[model samples]
Structure formats: structure tokens, C-alpha cells
Target: MVWKDETKEIYTEEPKEENIFKKEYGNTDDEFTYIEKTKGRDGEVKETVKVSIGKVSRYLLTKFNFKTIFGSKTDKIYFYESGMYIPKGKTKIKTEVEYLLDNKCTTHIVNEIIEKIKRKTEIDEDLFETFSENNLDLIPLKNGVYSIKEEKLLDHSEENLFTFQIPINYNPKSKCELFEKFLDEVLYPEEIEVMKEWFGFHLYRRYFIKKGIILLGEKDTGKTTLLDILIGFIGEKNKTGMALQTIAGGSDFTKLSLKDKHANIHDDLSSKDLSDGGGFKIATGGGHISAEVKFGDYVQFVPFAKQSHATNKIPPNKDVDDMAYYSRWMPFQLDNVILKPNPYLKDEIISKELSGVLNMALEKLKYLLKKNKFSYIKTDEEVKVIMERSGNPLIAFVSDVLEESENGIITKEEMYQVYSEWAKNTENLRLSKEQLGRNLEKNCKFIIAKKGTQKQGRYWNNVNLKGNYSTFLTSKKVIYLQSKDDVSLLQYNKNKSVESDVKEPEETKEEEEKIEQVKIK
Candidate 1:
């Protein structure tokens, strides 16, 4: 063999068959040659140990499936096991690698070997670009993953990175009678079907769709029980419990909690009105949300969690006319309280009926896909009424407490005073005087005009207080008017100038009937 050095060329004879054993026992110029020299008390060499760094590297590689995930700033080291790529700590990896060395080599040699092994195993991050939204049909289960759409078992791939596994296997024939009974007890028949679709949407990871479920009911109404069943179905570790108010406000930890979560369940929802719906809009609208790791930099990620909240008081929103926020909510009312609430009912349902529930969810998911939308028993008009009352305090106040006249005007100050008083009585948050004026013009088309006389301050046109609470209660000639598009100013008394053939909204009709019954009494 001939080789060129930096300064000269060297020639050497090729080894024969007799030299095969000699080549294996002795090393020539291989830098990976690991020789541990042990000395006697007299400082004389006692033994020469030959340690194969390649063997040690291979052993560590086989024992721990070390992988490097490339990042923009820094590479993350992880180990693959069960369908997850768990972050591997430097100290832990070093300790495992050291076990193979057994103190036979110097620290420098050990580190060199570890680095070489890492270089061999480290791969590009794009290689692991899997488990995307497109692959969400593959639901991870305890025994194995199953494709809900395909209705068949899927082979587990190394790219799968789900952290939690559902406890129950896919059983299409399974039936959950107890859970069905509980659903019937807590929700209307139509609502039960909506609940099925809700569960299936989460299972399918349909985060791209901008929708969420909100349940409103008083205490002991089985709201928590229903939410618990959902949490258990998704696996506790796969769900988060961030409050709706915090999420809407985009609190730092709220975004972090939602990462990798299949559902965000707020059983005890906050009663605070949602003044800021930006974060909520982004999350439910499939926009990338920023999450900051504890003591780390912020990272942008698309969250897959479906938000479900239950509250006694549905919080009012600042802007109900913003379809981006209100349209995302599918509200349902729960009134049937469990007479004798079973403490262990949730556990029983989860333990025995999860497989059945999964089957039902998949069935509904298919139906939702076919329909391209959710089928809700509660009409959109009904939901709009509930949202108006809970989302726009100004609209609710105008609808219930005020009346419009052919030629009427009320001072902005006086109207706000009356609104503030009514808000106090109704337990609604009153908007600021400035905000009230702006919203009145923008949403209600009621102009805030300056009076002809300089002394008379600005006043809203074409509307006035309905005398007093007593007069409002006794009024019978009132007629509700709204546009066909369901624009803002949900309800106000009809006048000659604003007449149309538009049918009255369901809520206004119901209120009118209630008032007629009061008059009859």
C-alpha cells in the first residue's frame, strides 16, 4: 500500500492471511484506538488494555435510541421510546455512556467517543416532520394506534411523537349505556348529539375549525361530571385546565398549558367578562399561538386542543358584533340537575365505557365531516340571544330597558346614568361612558349629535329611557326590529320610519309572550 504524507510518500507491504489475527490484536494509526495503560507501584507498565470505542459506541446506540432534533439556534437531543421523543438531558446521556466505558478510558477519550456516536445518530429535523394535522386521524391508544377514518389498525412509526395514549382500545361494537343516561340527564336529546360531535372533533384534532363549546348551568347541574368524562376520554395528561378568562387575556402560562393538549377543559369557568378576545380568537381560529417555556424563550406553535367550558354565569364580551369571537362559540344550556348525584359515576363511565364513547365519537365525527358542520339542537337565533345577553351588556340593556320614539332624544350623560343604574340592578358590567357612545354609534346607528343650543350637551337621537322600570314592565305596545343579516342593536322598539317585513327573532318573541302572560295575570 502507498500513502502520501504532508512531506513525503510512504510505501508498505499489504498484509497476508497470516497477519489477520495480528491486525485485530494490535492497532496501527487509527485515532479511535482506545488503549488503557495500567502501571505498577514502581511506575512500570503492568498491563496494556485494548478497549474498542466502536463497540462501546454501538452498545450505547443500541441501548438508548439517541436522536438530535435540529433547531434554529440550538439542537435538542432526545431519545425515542413508545411513540414519543422525550428530551434527553446531557447529564443523563453522559451517565449512560460512562457505564459502557467502566472507567477504562480517560475522560477526553470518553467524550470523543460519545461525540462520534452522536454525530452518527444525529439527523435533520425535517426527517421527523410527522404527526401533523393531516395525520390526526390516527388516534393513539394504549395497546396501539387506530385510524378512525380508515377503521383499521396503523403500524406505529418512529415519527409519532404523541406524549399520552388513550386508555381504551377502539371497539366499534362497544356501548356506553351509563354515559348515555348521564348525557340524557344533563343535556337535551339534540344537545347530546352535539356533544358527540364535539368529542369527535377533538379526537380528530380538527383544530383548523374555529369553534368551541360552552355549557351554562347552575350548581349541581352535572356540568363538572360531563367535563370530567371528556377529560378522562382524552387522558388527563393530554388535557389542560386553563381558565377561559386567562386564555382570552393571553396570560403567559395559559398558552404554555395548551401546547400538545388534546382539550382545554375549564369546569369552573371564570365569571369575569371577556374584554379581550384576541387570544381566544387566535387559538380557536387556528392561528399560531406563542407559548413561552418556563425560564426559556417564546416559541410559536399551532395548538390542537379543543376548548370546553362550563360556568354558572356566562361572561359578557366587549364586542358581541365581532363574529370572530361570538361565532366561535356553540352555547348550550343545562338545567336538569341530578337529583341524587352519584360520586363515582364519572369513574365508572370512564373505566367501563370509554371504548364505547370513542366509537360514538368516531361515528359522529364522520357525520360532521359529511355535513361539513355541526348539527346543534339549539338554533343560531337562540344562541345569538344568549350571546347578546351575556356578551353585549349595552345591547341587553337597550333591548330590555329602553324604547325608541319617532322624535325622541336623550342626553348621553342621562342615558349612561340610567344604563349604569340598570347594570347595577341586573348584575351586568357597565361600559365606560366614552366606549358606550362609540359602540352606540357603530353598532346601533344611533348618532351622538350636539344640540342646537350650546348649553345642551351631546345627546343620542331617536331613543330614550322607557320612563322607569315600572313603565318598562307594563309596556305592551313594544315591537322588536332587526335587520335580515342579524346586525347589531339586537332589539329596540319599532318606529314608523324603520318598518320592514323582517320576522322577529325568537328571543324577542319569547319575551313578548312572557310580557303578555304578565299582562294577563
Candidate 2:
């Protein structure tokens, strides 16, 4: 026997044609028997080999063995296994067969197919190798879409938390210019200064004073309109934009849970009755409203109302938390008096200019947010500027002047004179007493005094008369004497030397004795 190199050469031999089976195995109990196809010379059984046919191997026999035996056109084979013979008929075997083959041969065929596929695919093993080396795990899904675990998502929760610090320095020049444009072009130029002053003061307090802005006024006084304009300038849909939630009548306050990093605009607040525990309390006081909410399973206390409104009265002795919430806002009342329409309300060109200015301010705010810098306009200088620009000197000054004036009525001319005096006296040049009164009277009847006295020496002695309380002099120079005779006593400045010359005469000794006796009764 000669041997060849095991790795290089395969032994080849001429194939011999031999009968696959010569068997006559019978199962008498099953009523099935295998018929012998070939016999020895003496017609006796020489060899008994069982040939098995399966669904798959039977096709191989028909295509290969039968073609080899008869002709290429032939398509039949005879085979038998376990007392069953398969011919080209309905009785042919259809069960799966296990072929006993050499393991090395089977492995060689599979490896060849895999190698072919790999070569055709041109798989980049280096790419996967680099990824594995770097310990980077990536999952590729259909198309370009992919997802990571929620925990693995980048953290934006920290970015969402916002704490607006006080004393925001609202630019007066910019605010004034914008407001002037709005006044002159949009709605009312006269109101421009008023709006500017209002926005300036509130924003200043909000940013510097750490107060919330509250506007109270009658319907159509442009409260909501002004708010809408502000919102428009700020870009309501932007990331740093304002959020408006209009409260209808009887709506629960729990709907006010505001998202972080957003400004809330509450509109139509007056519709809610504050007499009963209603929306007004929620706006003034923060609390949880328990009601059968449409979507909630049970009544849950949700923290809603964040601002206050005069339309809603705050409950007395509200929770401390609610009061604290209410204290955050800076409230202002809009004047009901109508003035010339603001230019911003009518002139589109000026309105656009104002909007551009407001947009610039918004950009500045964005920059501040990015830098993590919190600032506000808190100086008295800034406040004065706001007051002057807002055209609301009268409103700002009225309260102070009313307290200072001898009588509430200061003449119209006197009002202007006082304003001029105040302008010179104060750093802000706010309005004076008379000016404030005149301004108040433009909208409603307010207290104003005549110049000097109309009848300085006149006296009323006998009649006790009463009417709507008109302005009265409390000075001793203007006297009202009590006399039953209807006689007017004319007297000079007697007792000028007396230390307390203006004492009323007492008719009291007997009356006082009688009052002491009332206790005995």
C-alpha cells in the first residue's frame, strides 16, 4: 500500500455498480412485507441488505441512481426500509431521514458556504474589532432611528428648573422707546408713557424688588390687550416665552400648575366670584383644590393659582404659603380715562419698530440666561425714569399729595404748579398734589380745593343742615356757631392774647352730672 500527503491529495477510486439491497423481510402482524428484487444463481437468498428510502434521499436515488442505471430520462428508483418498499407510487415514503455521514465531510461543506458568503459580503471585521476594543456599545435599528434607555438619556431636568431672581434691570431707554412707539403708533401715545412706566416699575420690582406685577382695571381698559402685546413681543411659543392661562367662571384653580421656566398670563379673572371660595382666593392665595377632576381617579390636591387679582378677594387668614405666593406680585391699576389712541395701536410701521426693540430686549434676556446672571433695575433713579416716561406722575403723586394737602381740592393751575415744584424737588420729578387730583378727576370725581377761601368770614349759626359731605374747612377761621335764636353774632379777633383762643364753650356741668347718673339707672 502506498500513501500520499494527507493535506494535498485525496485518494480516488473507480466506482463499482452493485445492488443496493437483496432483502425479503416480512412483518406478518403489520400485513407489510419487503419483496426481493434480485437473487443469486440458485434462486436462493444470498445477501440480506435493507435499503432505506426517505423523502429527501428518495429524490437523490431517483435522480442519481436511476439515471445512472437506466437513462438520464428515467426518474424512478426502488428502495426498501423496515419492511417498507418505496416505488414511484402513493405508498412512497415521505418521512424525514437522518443520514449517517462523516463529520469532517459535513463540516467542510458548511465552512465552504460560510466562506463564500463572507467573501461576497466584504464584512468589515476591523470596524467591529475597533468598537469592541473601545468598549463602545452601539445598537443600530431600522433606517437611522435608534433609542437609548430613558436613564441613559441626557439630563435636561436640571436645565428645566428656574428660579427668577429679583431686581431685573429693565432698560429704561429701550423700554421707553418701545412704549413711545407703541403709544404713538399702536394704541395711544398718551398711554405709552403710562404703559412704559407701568412695565418699567413692575419689571423692575419683578427683577429687582422681587415682586409680581398685578394690573387692575375696568373691562376694556386694555389690561388684557396690554398683556397680549407683551406676550407678542416676548414670543409666546419660544423657550423663554410667556404662558397665558385664561380662567373662565367656576373653573377649578388646580388647573394653574405652571411649568417651570415659563411666565403665566391669567386673563378673564374677574368672572370668578371671590365672595365664596372661588378663583379669586386661588389667585391671591395658593392652595390645592379638591374636586372630581375629569381625568383624575380621585380628588387630588394640585397646586395651581400663582398670582392675585382684585376680581378675586383673598380669603382672610389664608394659609401662610398662599399669602407668601400672593406677595410675589407687583400690582398696578390701569386708569379708566381714555386718552389719544397709542400710535402702536394704529401705525403698523411704528408697531414694527417697537416690536423690534422688544425682540432685542428678549435677546438680551436670553444672553443673561445663558450667562447664568440675574440682574434687575432697582435704583430710585430707574424708578423715577419709569415714572416720568409712563405719563403717570399724577397717579404716583396723588396719594402723597392728598396726605399733604390741607384740603383735597387743589386748583387745576395749582396742580400744575405743584407738579413743577415736585419735578424740581424729587429725583424722579413725579407729579404733585394738584396735578394728581386733576388726573384722578379726568376719570372720576376726586377731591380738589379752591384757591384761598371763597367766603372767608361767612358763618352759619341757627340751622343744622346735612347734605352729601362736600369739602369743608376745618380751620378755626371758618366757624359754624350753635345758636337757637337764629342770630348771627359778629365778633372781632377777641382774646388774641389768650393762649388757646379757639376753644368751644362748654354747656356741660349739668349734662356731665346727668351722664354720671345714667350708670346708676
**Per-candidate count of clashing residue pairs (backbone under 3 Å):** 1, 39
Question: Which pairs clash inside model 1?
Answer: 317-391
Which candidate achieves the best TM-score against the true structure?
1
Q: Best candidate, lDDT-wise?
A: 1
lDDT of the candidates, in the order given: 0.66, 0.32
Candidate 2 lDDT over residue span 66-86, tens digit each: 111122232222233222222
Per residue, candidate 1 scores C-alpha lDDT tens digits across 124-216 of: 564443454557677877656887667876765666765456666777689988887777666655677888889888776657567888887
Give TM per candidate. Answer: 0.66, 0.28
lDDT of 2: 0.32
* Candidate 1 ranges with C-alpha deviation above 4 Å: 1-35, 38-43, 46-54, 72-75, 88-118, 126-129, 159-164, 251-254, 293-298, 377-381, 390-521
